[model samples]
Target: MKLGELFQEIPMERVHRYAPERSLDLITNESKACRPGALYVAIPGQRVDGHWFLKEVLERGAEAAIVQHIDESLPLCQIEVPNSRRAWSALSAVYYGHPSRGMMVYGITATNGKTTISFMLDSILRGAHHKPGLIGTVKIRLGDELLAAQMTTPEAFVLQRYFREMADHGLDSCVMEVSSSALEQDRAADVAFDVVSFNNFSREHIDQHGSLEAYWQAKASLITQASSKSVAVINLDDARIRTLQGQSAASFLTYGIASKDADLLAVDLQVSGPTVSFTLLIPRPVYLAGVDRTVPAGAWPMKVGSPGQHTVANALACCAMALAGGIKPMDLAPGLLAYGGVERRFEVLYHGPFTILDDHFANQSNIRTTLSSLSQMDYNKLHICYAIRGNRGVIVNRENVAAMAPFFKDLRVGRFIATQTLGEVTEKDVVHDEERAAFLDEAVRCGLAPELIPPLDEAIEAVLDAADSGDLILLAGCQGMDLGAGKILTLLAQRHPEQKAKILWPLNDRVCGQTIPHPPNKKETQQ
Candidate 1:
């Protein structure tokens, strides 16, 4: 494409040296990714400033650089802008041909329920005969292809590329999880959505976001930025989401469980065995702005393959967005029935006499939900295992341990094992002393005993040794527990080789126990 065509969509601050006829090959923020004829964007970051690497990128192959400051001496074309992040976002869409603008893009943000809603919404889109794609913490999907996701929301450049691919694949709609980090960093700055929803919120990522108020601001921006034509589906039960209603210019569609004023209400929620059933009531005088305001007064039996009352709430949000998009309640049954569950949210890994569940519990809300679900299940004995949360800082570690304390007290397990990756982690994942101290202090404060274990291999042995045939083993944590299920199955394969095929676990790209561990770094603070 020519330089003039790329900048045609978004206005530039000032072009220092213009060559509208010049051919452009690619656009990138990272200096290392620059190739011949690439336009490098100097986006300022937390640790390293792209401005400092302008000379390096120019030395390599970058011909034109978009920067906040003008550099006179560099032998390259420079475009100056006030905010490169937003510029980068706009440029990315222009480079890839604004793909999301044509489709019905549904963005969902919250402390939890993001993944579950993504799956539920995807299923709903399919029922409407719309080919859809998904992008979230669990994975990214384009039709039948599931690729491992590096983040909950990828960078703007990558996002535009994925949108282009989805559009080329003939996808008419998309439902994606929008993370607070991505929102704060303007990763999805230029994404124009047809509908946006804010699920429940909680105290999560305070360490990274600096404060709860800041985290909420990051999450609320998605709803606030929507155009007036778009619809904002909100949770009526959550005060945090309710408070942001005035900030949004978009039409509002409210859904809730306990709130009687909700436009879409799910009532009489019951969890039986491994399925959740509820009566979806779209009462008359339903107060949705742009949608059919007066929905037919009726109660429909709704059952989900996923187990939890919370999952039903997630489905309610999906129904709200779908209804706002012009789907009737009667038409929603096919999609809700077709939906199963996302991987690792509350996935059953092993289903023999003993059962194993894999959950990535990063916050108090997530830990509480999983524990509450466990309380409802029929199990003779309950064994809990946690991975040593690393690099999240002391506050999160303390809160997570505080969340698990009640479960430990209720279960009355003799002792639970906590394992670390033994420095088998990157610099961003090293455990800090204060974090471990917080966990230990909270465990002791709650009258629970926890044994610190090293090298996950021995921790699994300890948990299995204490387990009976009907016991439930929960392998839980964030980064440290990614490979926990695979390792447990590997051990089971070694003991009972015939049952290897029967073992069920969350499917991901995490390595097994056989992979060699990274050597310890003296600078790193190992727990």
Candidate 2:
């Protein structure tokens, strides 16, 4: 594509060394990845600014560059823009022929359940016999291919490339998890979403976003950015989500479990073990695109192959997006049933002598919802081995421990064992002293004497040794607990070699964190 074609419709600050007719073969934000005819976008980052790499990228390339700051000294051809990130996304879409525009694109954004909702919707589209792709926290799927995802939402260049590949592979639709950071960075600014959803929100990534209000605004942009021809899936049960009903020009599709005025509702909800069954109340006629007919208003029995009442909200969000996209209601239940759950979102690791569950207990809301769900299940005693969220500030740590304190007190959990995952995490995830103190101090304040275990492997062994038959063992936390489930199952296998097969059944289909030990970095904080 020519320089002018790629920059078409994209607002620019000023153009230097005008190259409207300049042909470009590639575009990249990274300086090292620049090729002969590539356009290097100098994005100012948190630590290292891309503008600093202009000399380097210019050395490797023989073409133009996009910049927020123009340097007149260097002979580098520059296309100045106010926001390099937004420009990169917009230009990437143009370079990729705006692939998302050719396919039905769905986005789900929230502090939690984004992965689950994306998976459920992907399954629903597949069950309806439509080839669907997925981009989420767990993995990225394009046709029969499954690529591991590095983040919740990938960068603009990669995202556009993935969409382009999916379209070329004959994919009819794509479902993705949109993260607040991605929205704030304008990573998904150019995605042409046919349907988008705003699920529940909570205080997460506050440090990265600077404030709760800013975080909310970042997430709220997903729904607000929907085009007039699209649909915005709003969760009416959440007051925050309900406020967005009339905020967008897109057609509204409201769903809820508590609000009676929702266009769709989940009633008679039941969370039994690893499955949540509910009767979905569809009060109005919905067009089923797969069947090419509109189904009349009625209640239909629905089941999500994942646990917790929180999953009911996820299921409803998925149902709303799928239904609005004209998917058959009958296909939804089957798709949700086949989901099986994400890797660490309350995944059941072993259900043998003592049941073991793994969860990404990231924040206060997540920890509360996860423990609250376990409170409903029948377990002799709940043994929670928490991997303290590392590098996430003291506030989040305090809130997380505080959230679990009440559940621990009510569930009669004798000891609250917390681990720093010492060597098992990257430098970014290293637990700070203040964060550790916050968790411990909060637990003590909530009338619980928490046991501090530094090593992740030892923590798992300690919890497993203490847990007895009929008790529930919950390996919890975000990055710190990624290796907890694998370690727990391995120790269980060593303890009972004969029952090893039964104990390790859950590891067979895990999409994420399947690798053991995680090859810890020795530079991480030890204590």
Candidate 3:
């Protein structure tokens, strides 16, 4: 492709000997990934600048370079753009032939439930025979193939390349989690989304985004990015999302559990054991392909395999996306039930006379939801082993402890055991002084006494020793609890060696295990 054509959408500052016949087959921002015919774009980043590697890229036979400023020292074909990041995204889409345009793409942005919605949407699209691809926090799926995710959202260049791969692999639809950082970085600048959903938002990424408002803006930008041709699925229950009402120009599809104004509303809900069933009140009808009748407007009995109010919100968001895309409500009902669920979103790691559940309780909202759900479950004893949050600063730790304290005030079951995860987690995953002080203060203030154990392994063992057959053991936390599922399996082995082979299969289903296509560069639990 010609270098001039690729810069059509990008504002060019100057064009210095721009080659119209330069056969640029590959594009990269990283010099290490550049091939002989690749065009290397110099993007100024926080840690490193690609411009400094100009000599290396040119030496490796790069055809051209797109940069913020002209490198007068080198005579390589250069196209100077106002913003390299935007230019990189625009050019990659052009080079990849805008693969996302050929497929139905749903971009879900939320503080939570992005991964869950992606999986639910994948299942729904598949129910209609639309071969679906997924790119989210858990993993990347292209039809039958799965790769572990490196981040919530990939860089624009890498993302476009993956879309191109999916297009060639014969996937008709793709669902991805669009992170706030990704939006700020201009990662999804080029993908033409068919549907965009904002399930819910909470106080998260405050440190990285610098403020609550900045974080909200990052999430809101995704919904606002939708073209008039697209459908924006908004969660009416999310107070942050409610502010986005009458905000975007795209055709809006509203979903909620409590809001009667929602076009796709769930009512008459029932939660029993591991499943939750609800009556989906579809006031608006949607077309069903190759069927005599449309998805008739009425209360359609819908059930999700997962529990929790958050799961209901996720289900409603996916159902709204499918309905807006013209899929039947009847078809989606089965899909939601079929989704076995991703790892660590309140996954039951073990089930016997007692049950062991592991959850990724990263933020305050998640902690509150998980605790509330656990309180409702039928168990003689509830033992919670929480690995104290690390890396996340004082504010988050304060909110988390506050959330925990109120729920455990009555001590419905056994005492809570807190772990610093000494050897089980990375050094960065170790609890800080502020986190410790916040937790202890909140626990005492709420009139609850939680046992403090420094080592996560010992804390976990403490829970196991205290648990009876009719008890429920909850392994919870963020980075530190990555080893929770594995550690529990090891402990379970010691408790009952005879049950080893029968329960060993769940370890493969864990987030840290090979069940997902995890990149080699991604961090593992320190244990």
Candidate 4:
């Protein structure tokens, strides 16, 4: 790819360069990983700025640098773009040889359920024999290799690089969870998506976005950026979907449980234990060549690995996207039945005489939804070992505690253990023991007597000790509860070897207990 060709795609008129002939081999940030002829993007970060290390990147053989502020004295190729973040996205696409052009990319964006839907789409694509690459909060799966994710959506340059790598690996499709910040910053601008699915949204990231409307606009940009021929599969059940439909020029397909007029509708819903069986009604025949195939609407029995009504909704969205992407309706039934829930989404840890659920419910709605789903299950007593984060900023902490209050008010539980992940830093201040104590005390004042513990391990032990036959133990939080839950389950199995035969995890998978505690860091208050 020539420099002129790369610049042609970007909206910039003129670019200031200190070295134009530099043969860019790659774009990276890590000075150690800098290769000859590579472009080092100097990003202005909180802890450290790449601009400060320009001399280091240049010394390490970086041929070019993208900087927010230009230094004329630098002999290296310096491209002064309006925003380095946007430039990273453009440069990465060009450097990666525009891998997204050859692949069908589906950007799933929402406040919650983004991870679940991304997982479902990947699973469905695999079932249909399409090689899929996934980029989300949990991890980035590029064929056989998996790497822990540092962000819900990585920086634009890195994203393009990953997409190119996936393309090189012969992946037919890429599904990613598009965060609002990513969209607002134009991380996904250069790439064309085959489909963009709008899951339900709620009030979140207010601290970053400032307001709900701003957040909504950021999410809406994903749909607006799609090409005219692309498809926008939306959930009519969400009120925001209507506004999004008005903004998009792409072909529209709506799916919902409530709307009878939806392009795909789930009817005659049945919730039996962990399985949700429902009848899908697609009133119109899908036209294929000369044949107008009448897709028979019938009752489909499917078992989601996790137990939640939200999961059912996610399944419907998956089915809609799959069908819109040219997958047959018949294939959807089997795919749904074979679909396994993603890690940490209503993941059941153990089920012996007692049950343990490991769900990553980080928000208010998710917390409420998870509790509501558990209320539907047959358990004598629900013992919740809820680990709340203190560094979530004061507003989020209050919202989360308020959400849990209603569930605690209704359910009769043997014990409610409330613990905090100490030394966690957020956009706000550091969440220390004192802050957590205050939050827990507030919750207790609201009629929920939650036992506060310093470490998550101790909280798990307490929950297990309090639980007996027919008692349900739930470990709910976003941070590192997976390892804590796993360790407790393993200890329980070792103590009562006979109950190991009856032990059940949410997905019936073994929990790998591993804890990597965070190093202490100073917290800064949100502006």
Candidate 5:
């Protein structure tokens, strides 16, 4: 593929130079990974700029350099643009030969449930025999191989490269969680999605986005990016969905529990232990033209892997996406039944004398949903051991604490321990003690006596000791709760090896553990 052909959609001024004659073998970031005649994109990132290592990339046999500014002294062919990020995304799409164009891509953005929906979509697609690739917070999958992902979304160049790899690997469809920062920065600018799904938004990433409206705009951009022929699936149950509808150009498809006007709606919902079944109502018969017929404007029995009202909504969103993309409704039932769910989203680790839920509720909305889900489950006492990140934005932290407080007050729980993950970081430059104190005070005021433990390990131990048989032990947090959860699970297994048979890993699917990819010259640190 020629560089000239790749930048056709982009204006000529944005296209500084095109090396048509040069044949590139690969696209890379690390100098060592660069092969001869490879396109090296010099990204100016937090720690180090790729421009500083231009000589090394050239020495390792890169043919050209895509950069924001040119370094005339370098011997490599330089292509300068106003924004290197946008250029990288455009070039990657071309380099991958526009893999998304060959497949139905669904981009889902939200503060929570993004991972679960991605997994659901993957299972549904596989059941229908359409090979699906996934890219999100957990990992990236191109068919059977799983690649560890550092961020919820990767940089433009890396993302495009993965798309190309998926295309080569014979994936017919791709489902990804599009983060707000990724969209705001143009990481997904070049890719055209077949369906864009909006999950509920909340106050998150305020530190980077600066305001709630800006964060919403970043998420809304995904819907706007879709073509008119593409389908925009919005959750009518979410208040923010109204704002997104105004920004979308794609054909509208709505799903909700409360809204009767929704194109696809859930009715006759029933929640049993570890299984929630629902009836899906489609307004009209969906025809794929030559493909199979979906639901004939009637209710279809739908079963989700997890036991939560939120899961029911997530299934509805997945159904909307599948239906919009021409997937038959009959095919959805088998796929949905087979879905074990995504890891760490209200996962049950132990259920012997006591029940242990390993839930990752990072934001305010998620915290509320997880608590509400637990309330529905039968338990004598609900003992919650939660940790919050110190670096999270002030508004998010406040809202998360406030939302969680009401749930804690309602819980007939024996105990609730609210702790900080990172040991109090209070200094002249950073004062997080007050924020931490505020969260504890808020929880206590909500009717439950909340305690603040310095370290997460101690908090877990204290909570477990208080829990008895028929009681629930829940470890919920966004950061490094997995480590604590893993350790606790091991301890529980060793203490009650007989109960090991009862201890269930969330999702019921095993992911091969791998290190997340990092930029050049960066050190890997455990969070």
Candidate 6:
């Protein structure tokens, strides 16, 4: 691509030096990765500024540079931009042939359920016989190939590369999980989206975004900036998400279980052992993706293999986005029924005499949802092995414990086993004394009288020993609880030796958090 072509529509503050006809072989933000014919983008970051590395990148033979600040001493062709990150996104999209425009792109942004909804959309598109790709926290799917995902939303360059690969391979659509951080950094600024959903929001990433309003604004941008031709799926049940009403120019598709004005409502919902069945009541005419026509007012009985009120909400968002993209309503049931679900989002590991469930109970909202879903199930006893959140600040830990307090009283929780995961977590996730104190103090105030368990393995063992025939054990936490599933399953296999294969084989090939990608370099880490 020519240097002039890459800057076609990107706004620039000033052009320090121009090399319009220069043919660039590569584009990168990393100074270390610059080659002779490469274009380097200088991004200002929290700890390290790409501008500071200008001297290094130029010395490494970068042909030209995009910068927010012009350095007169560097003998380089520089295109000064108001915002380097946004320019990088725009340039990368252009360099990749604007691949997203050729496909039916679906973007899902929320505090939770993004991964499950992405997977649900992928299944729906595949059921309609349209080749689809997925970009989410669990994995990135480009046709039949699967790659480990480093974040909920990849950096702009990596994201564009994935879209380019998908488009070039003849894939017809993509379902991507857009994150708050990604939006704040303009990582997904230039991608074309056909359908965007703002499922729900809660207090999260406050520290990263510096405040709650900033975080909300970041998530809201996805819907507000959507094109008029696209569909914006909104969760009417959430008051915060409701504020987005009348804010977007795109067609609105509202969904909820309680809201009467919802365009799509889930009625007669039933939560059985491992399935959630609901009657999807479409109140009016809506676009059906698969049939390429409008679907009249109707109610369809839909069933998802994954059980929970939260799963029903996720399915509703999936149905709305799929229908908007031309998928027939008839295909929704099978697509959702076939979805096994993402790992650690109320994942069931054992269902024999007793039940074992694993979940990433990260924040207050997630805890409320997980516990509320468990309240609907029948069990002899509910044993909660909670791995105390670590390194996430005292306020977050206190709030998480507080969220569980009401559920503890309501569900008559059998036991609360808390673990610090002393040896299982990395240095960044290590539980500090203050965080532990906050959790304990909050639990005691809420009458949770939690028993302290040191290591994660011991916590799992304690839960297993306390489990009865009709008991339901929940292995819950964030990074600390990632290995909980495998540990508990191994313990179960030992206890019931004859059923080892049945206990472990089901999740043998499907488990996550085991695969480790190559360690990133310093520049890649900063991005």
Best by lDDT: 6
Query: Which is better, 1 or 5, measured by lDDT?
Result: 1
Q: What 10-residue stretch in candidate 1 is worst by lDDT?
A: 518-527
List, residue by residue over 1-527, the lDDT tens digit for candidate 1: 77788887777778776667766666778898776667889988777899998888878866688899878887778888888888888888888788998777899998988988888988987877778899887678766666677778988888987897788888888888999999998888878788899988999999899999999889888888878877888998998788876577788888889889887899888876577788889786454454334455688887777777678888888888887776677888788888877666787877887888888887999999988878777777777678878999888988888888877656645548887756566667667777778888888888778888867778877777777878888888887777777778778767888776665334344332224332332212221
Give the true-structure RMSD of model 1: 5.6
Model 4, runs deviating above 4 Å? 1-17, 29-36, 44-56, 59-61, 285-306, 422-430, 433-438, 498-527
Query: For every model shown, what is its TM-score relative to the native structure?
Result: 0.92, 0.92, 0.88, 0.87, 0.85, 0.91
Q: Provide the global lDDT of candidate 2 against the true structure.
A: 0.83
lDDT per residue (tens digit) for residues 445-512 in model 4: 67778787757678878888988888888887776464565657667877878766554233243322
lDDT of 3 by residue, 1-527 (tens): 77667766667788776786877667778887666668899989887988999888888778889889888788787888888888888888987789999988889998876777888888878777778889988788766667877688998877987898899899888898999998988989899888888888889889778999999899899888777777788988877798786677677778888887777888887875578888889886644222222445777888888777567777888888887777766788878888777677888888887888988887877888888888778888789988778877777877787788777744466858988888766566678888787777777877667799988778888988888878898988877787778877888887788999766668764555334443432111111
Q: What residue pairs clash in candidate 6, if any at all?
A: 289-326, 289-327, 290-326, 290-327, 290-328
lDDT values for all models: 0.79, 0.83, 0.79, 0.73, 0.75, 0.85
Give me the displacement of residue 206 in model 2, in angstroms.
1.1
Worst 10 residues of 2 by lDDT: 518-527
Q: How accurate is candidate 1 locally (lDDT)?
A: 0.79
Residue 337, candidate 1: alpha-carbon lDDT = 83
Q: Give the 10-residue window scoring lowest on summed lDDT in candidate 5.
A: 518-527
| lDDT at position 222, candidate 1 | 89
What would the per-residue lDDT of candidate 6 be over residues 1-527, giving only the tens digit for each residue?
Answer: 79998878777778766888998767789899887778899998899999998989888888899999899887888999889889889998998889999999999999978888898888878777889998988788877677777688988888898898898789999999999999999999989998899998999877678888999999999999887778888999999899897697787778888998988899998876578889999999865332345755789999888888788888988988888777778878888888887788898888988899989998888989999998988888899899998888888898998888988766756778999998988787899999999999998888788889988888889988988889999989988887888888988899889999999864665536567563343333332
Candidate 4: residue 501 Cα off by (Å): 8.2
Cα deviation in Å at residue 163, candidate 1? 0.7
lDDT of candidate 2 over 118-211, digit per residue (tens): 8888888887888999998888887777777778899898888889889989998999999998999999999999889998988888889889
Residue 104 lDDT, candidate 3, scale 0-100: 84
- Tens digit per residue, CA lDDT, model 5, 370-429: 888877888888888877556564555667777777765557877777767544233311
